[model samples]
Target: MFKSGLAALIIVLLANAEAQFGVGPPFGVGPQFGVGPPFGSRPPAGFGLPSLHGDGFPGPHPRPHPFPNPRPLPPPRPLRPPRPLPPQPPQFSSLRLCTTTQLEQDKCLYALDIAGNNSIDLKLECVQTDSFDDCLQAVQTKEADLVVADEHEYLKARSADLVPLLYAHETLTSYYIAVAPKNITLLELSNATLDVNAMDERAFHAAALFNLHRGHDLCDQAAEGDVTIQIIDSADYDPTDDELLICADGSVLYAGDYDYSECNIDAGLELGIFAPRPYDTNRSFTRLLQNVFDTLINSLGQESEVWNFFSDFQGTSDVIFKNDTSGFSLIPVNRNGVTEQKFTSLHCDQVSLDH
Candidate 1:
């Protein structure tokens, strides 16, 4: 038994010496236990052989080649010029000039601009319309600076504050004249059909003429003749040929004075330019226009044809805006207690022959 124990002890001591002399597993070895690849052998599936330097010991870790070929650095980008700023709008003094007729609008603006002589920069906004009501509305809404309209339109829109700046002086006075066979008296012509040049004007005049004799105002229903008043184009009709004709004193029929005589209907409204209420009065548009006219006259010289155009208007035709007529004078404000609607009966009942 002693001899067996001694042999077993010697075997144990040999194993311990071998382990201590570096002929055993590494200290605290983990789960990865394997022998390195043989020299010159391909590496394992994932791991690469360590890179070796001239020193012969395993040098450093093998770097991964992520791409087959690395691209060269891009050349430096070119410098760009800065962009330009946007343009600005031209500045000028602006004023709105309103007119009902195209001829008046264009000529007025041109004349005013010419009068300014480029010393006074004027940016004009023009509003041209066919209806007189629209022109008044434009001025009322402050869209227009000024307007030149007929007497009826002016009266319709006029208030205590509104006043006329200019009066288009008509040479011939307006008077309602009735022409019929010498046999018919004015009262007997009640149911008689009448032809007239201006339906609105003459109609009112007719009513007024009748009221003078009857001593009371006539409503539209009662004012109308017993027979339907046929609105005929008096331009084509001869006063002597028509059985009955009612027209203004200056109307075409008046040219044939031999055929017709005035019916003594003196009620008539003169045509004029009424400046829009307080704005026109307060802004002194009247003064401005007067100044413009004076300036034009002075700049063109008093003897220029332009002067004649303004001053030398004969009683031949209606005012021609193209001629730059400036002979307008202020008309006296005589409402004559007449309302604008008083003549609605004349125009409302008849088909608008003008349109």
Candidate 2:
């Protein structure tokens, strides 16, 4: 045991000595870890096979070969001096100017850089479609040099860098309802029946006005009983009070289909259309319709030609938008409306700031 102990001590000391000189396993001496090359000198000879020669020259250092003819850059594109961008394109033919309605037709037609009438190039061939956004895309991509559109459209054109020339329809020609069905009655207020069938929100408002104007006064004297005239909303209307084509007593149902011809009205039927009277004290219905109609048509520039387009659309020829000629000029030049449903019915010409 004593001899074994001596051998173990000597073995440990020798391992520590070897570790100090880095001649043993790396971790045999922790403190010796940082003891390395003092200067930029490499490892002493025989540490490992020399990757480099003892001579100043590098061992197997890569050498350069003779310049094997450098490839030329093809003569610098022949110095063409820009060529003036091809005159900014002389009228981009086959390009389309997409816009809608009477108002935005001009914005899609030209670059703002060249919007002046003097500089405007009408030579540019343009096919007009119905979306202002589409028109702007064409111009932005240099596809269409110009886009002619409504005033509102030009205001919204994406490229502010473009120029716009204002072309306006001096007069606004809108439409109104003269005798739509809804304007015939208070809708649900009274027991009176109307001869017509359909109408709009404005017509509904007129119906309220008609009833209010007719009753609340001397006209009320006609119905001294429990019958009273009150304006009711369309949603509140009761079906029983809404008898279509009610023939009253002494009504001229047989007055014939055409009132111009002969027809005798039954005197006791309790339902009939009143005759057109000159005084028309109860002509509140017609008056209400007239006011709405005037506002709508006059708003649309109630001139005869414009008026005819609205109410005279027999649609005898073209298959475009339907001709709703109820006595108004219905020119299609349709643009987008606030809601898609309100396109024709609610679309209108708005005020614009022209430059």
Candidate 3:
């Protein structure tokens, strides 16, 4: 029994010595017991460890993936084109002018044609009336939009609610000078014979000044005194050196040598283009008139006989505007008033009369 035990102990020591001496399973055979490889040996295929040479037996090492399975980004949304903007409305479609006579209406139509040819964007139409009062009524009732007339005429109708938009002259003052041998005062001419050209438009304007100086109404001179006022044609009337010549400021008799600052009667009035209060409030309408006036004035020297802005039409005198008008100037806003006092209060020098 002791000899058999001794042999069994020898067999167990031999197995332990083989493991400690770097000896293991035979070639091409896996370890029967769970044991690790030697220090210098490579791990078998299909193991978790990476291979040192070439591709590993299982497969190439997968690139480190931040996400194991990622979804592809959706196709970039197509850029939406910007939306289109809407159209804007016009400031004004058209402008209408008021006229008193058929000849005046014809002149307005000619002015419209001239505006169209000159590229002025204003659409002007004319409304004819029986008389100047009827024209004012048409404007007040909105049947007409504007009127070109003497400022005094407009002042007579304060209830018409009209406003001056532009002036046809810088200074509308027409000087009435009395020429009487340079010796007699204007008051002394009460009993003297006063000669005036009947055909002249200024002859009537001088009547007021004559009445002012003489301190009596010349129209009813027989009731006041024997102030013989003779109205004769300009060509036939020849004044003697002793007679009185109450003529306009720029009359040919003065030879441009007259100083009207003294011995003169100034009628401070103007020819203006006027409109209703509502039309005056529209800045666009004001701009349109300024453009139209500037265009017409610029075309004055040009040779076009079809239209004349400042001349007589169809044998009529001062059809739409005064024939003596040189140019136009814009009046200050809100300056139009019911009384002549308001107009006389304006400082003509300070006002911006520019187009």
Backbone clash count, each prediction separately: 0, 52, 0
C-alpha lDDT (0 to 100) for residue 113 of candidate 3: 79
Query: lDDT for every model?
Result: 0.48, 0.33, 0.58
Q: Rank the candidates by lDDT, best first.
A: 3, 1, 2
- Residue 302 of model 2, lDDT score: 28
TM-score of 3: 0.52
TM-score quality measure for candidate 2: 0.20
Positional deviation of 154 in candidate 2, in angstroms? Answer: 3.2
Q: Candidates sorted by TM-score, descending order?
A: 3, 1, 2
For model 1, name the residue pairs that clash: none
TM-score of 1: 0.42
Writing each residue's lDDT as its tens digit, candidate 1 over 1-355 gives 9999998998797687554432433323323434544433434434533445556545565677898699999999998878887654322244465677666565556555554654543344567766667777777776776566554454455642345666544333333445545445546455554444444654455544444334443333245454433333233335554445434332333334433223233343445555555544444455565554444445443355443324323442232232334345565322323334434333342324231
Measured with C-alpha atoms, the lDDT of residue 211 in candidate 2 is: 32
Q: Which ranges in model 2 have alpha carbons more than 4 Å from their true place? A: 1-96, 99-130, 158-160, 172-355
Compared with the true structure, the alpha-carbon lDDT of candidate 3 equals 0.58
